[model samples]
Target: MAEAAELSDQPLFSCRNCQNPLALRSNLLSKNFWGKTGPAYLFSHAMNIIVGQKEDRQLITGLYTIADIYCCNCGEVLGWKYLRSYDVRHKNREGKFIIERAKISKEY
Candidate 1:
């Protein structure tokens, strides 16, 4: 699927190694962003296939802690899931699934 130049409509993603369905095209977190850790190129409001654990280091956003996410099936490092604190803005964006495009199987 990655060989194609354009992405498919309503694309459903999978883990590149195990083919486990992850997120959809609509789940993209919008604009790609770079952080101190690296880059979170995509984000989804929800992703059932990903599992994460809290990390000690937090990001630039106060009350916005990050967790490392991995594939439930293959145990491959996916991206991250943000666990927001009491801050209103941070709470609003909680449960977002930030991902790395290259790590996920592309649909084209």
Candidate 2:
């Protein structure tokens, strides 16, 4: 399938429950670099989102640890947040979000 086209200058991504803007199309991590696997879309980036310690899972990626990112409005499992707790060779993907692009809609 073709990627969703941007409707505005900065496409506002929103939650399904409350229609709250979560991220933007410009913030897409796939276009720039390699990202983690999401529900559907690959190379997603969780740049601007809320992160919490509680219920956060520590997923090991080489040496970096990743946590779950929830929706600020609905507390939904939006994606994963990178935690740079380990000492990896390179600190490129230190902190990022591989959000589920399918869960979010491109709001005009």
Candidate 3:
């Protein structure tokens, strides 16, 4: 009963393609982010995601070693995870995730 209550209180973000739960609204850190397409969100945690190979990419912020994240259920390319950041200024985002706004839907 308590678990159900907790789940109900926490809104979820799911994949737009297959409705796979990706992250919780509580884990959302920032919405002022950019992805390959457009707006993205920074999340402190994410679930049901497959982290792809680590590679160095020069983003607008700086060079970062990131891995492409995919939906585990439908294998849709959702976003990427920051594996390593070359810049100290971006160190806080090292273990975080950037999920594209267009790829996910918010569930109440």
Candidate achieving the largest TM-score: 3
Ranking by TM-score: 3, 1, 2
TM per model? Answer: 0.66, 0.61, 0.93
In candidate 1, residue 20 scores what lDDT?
A: 68
lDDT of 3: 0.94
Question: Candidate 2 or 3, higher lDDT?
Answer: 3
Clash totals for all candidate models: 1, 1, 0
Candidate 2 clashing pairs, residues 3+ apart or interchain: 46-97
Q: Which digits, one per residue and each the tens of the lDDT, describe model 2 over residues 1-108?
A: 132343345676777666767777666666332334545332345433578663434354455566667777778777666666455563555565666655677676
Residue 14 in model 3: lDDT: 94
**Runs in model 2 with CA error above 4 Å?**
1-9, 31-48, 54-63, 85-90
- Local error of candidate 1 at residue 1 (angstroms): 22
Residue 13 displacement in candidate 2 (angstroms): 1.5
Best by lDDT: 3
Rank by lDDT, highest first: 3, 1, 2
lDDT of 3 at 83: 91
